[model samples]
Target: AQSVTQLDSQVPVFEEAPVELRCNYSSSVSVYLFWYVQYPNQGLQLLLKYLSGSTLVESINGFEAEFNKSQTSFHLRKPSVHISDTAEYFCAVKQSGGSYIPTFGRGTSLIVHP
Candidate 1:
């Protein structure tokens, strides 16, 4: 089955702090990487993706991730975080045929303390 695993279930940080979300995947074939962020009860928004070119990808919102083929991982990072960054982050992967829907991880909740 198509699957993605998020190592951390939750991450807590202070305002203006830094945060990272770990992600890993397993697939028989090639795949695309994606990071989506869910704010509170809201739906997810695409943070970044690694489709074809470079292994590195970044979102407009100051988050970035690197696709590592050897490790089969795509981990997200932010030098500093804000309270507004508090939300649920999900790591997803899609297959090459475009026949596979994105498989999301269990999600990691980021809590920002004031």
Candidate 2:
């Protein structure tokens, strides 16, 4: 079994500033993770994921996440955040070949200020 934890429930940041949403997981087996972003009044969207390739993965919108096996973390980072980036971020984990469903975190709300 696997579980995901998002350290911060809410992160307030100014526009164009660097931001990071910390995520950690616990599992006895190898697993893959995903970062999802949910904008207001919208469904959750896939921001980035770390499966089997390089430890680091990036999204088209400039967000990136690094899967650290030692730390069991997959923190999401953005060099410069925008107002549009304000949303709820969720971290999910699924054990390799375990289940089709993934365990999800409580979610972290990113509020970008101008």
Candidate 3:
């Protein structure tokens, strides 16, 4: 089994400011971690994932997440945030080849202020 934790429930930042939403995970077995973004009144969209190969993964929209094995963390970072970036971000984890269903953490709400 795998457990995911999102450090902050809410994050406030001004437009174009650098921001980071932390995520940590613990599991007995190898796991896959992902970051999802949910805009208001919309479904979750894949932001970035750390499945294999490089520890770092980036999204097309300037968001990046790095998978750190030693720290057991996969923190998401954005150098410059925009107003449209305000949304709910969720961290999810699932045991590799164990279960297709993933366990998600309580989402972190990113509030981009003007």
By lDDT, is 1 or 2 better?
Answer: 2
- Order of candidate numbers by lDDT, starting with the best: 2, 3, 1
Collision pairs in model 1: 17-81
Q: Give a tens-digit lDDT track for model 1, residues 1-114.
A: 568999999999888878888999998889998999999778999989898999989888789999998999999999888888999999999897576788999999989899
lDDT of each: 0.90, 0.95, 0.94
Ranking by TM-score: 2, 3, 1
Candidate 3, residue 97: the lDDT equals 62
Q: In model 3, how many backbone clashes occur?
A: 0
Best of the candidates, lDDT: 2
Which runs in model 1 stand beyond 4 Å of their true positions? none
Tens digit of per-residue lDDT, candidate 2, span 1-114: 888999999999999999999999999998989999999999999999888989999999999999999999999999999999999999999988645679999999999999
lDDT of 1: 0.90
User: Each prediction's TM-score against the native?
Assistant: 0.94, 0.97, 0.97
Backbone clash count for every predicted candidate, in the order shown: 1, 0, 0
Q: Cα deviation of 102 in candidate 1 (Å)?
A: 1.3
Candidate 3 per-residue lDDT, tens place, 35-80, comes to 9999999999988888899999999999999999999999999999
List candidate 2 stretches off by more than 4 Å: none
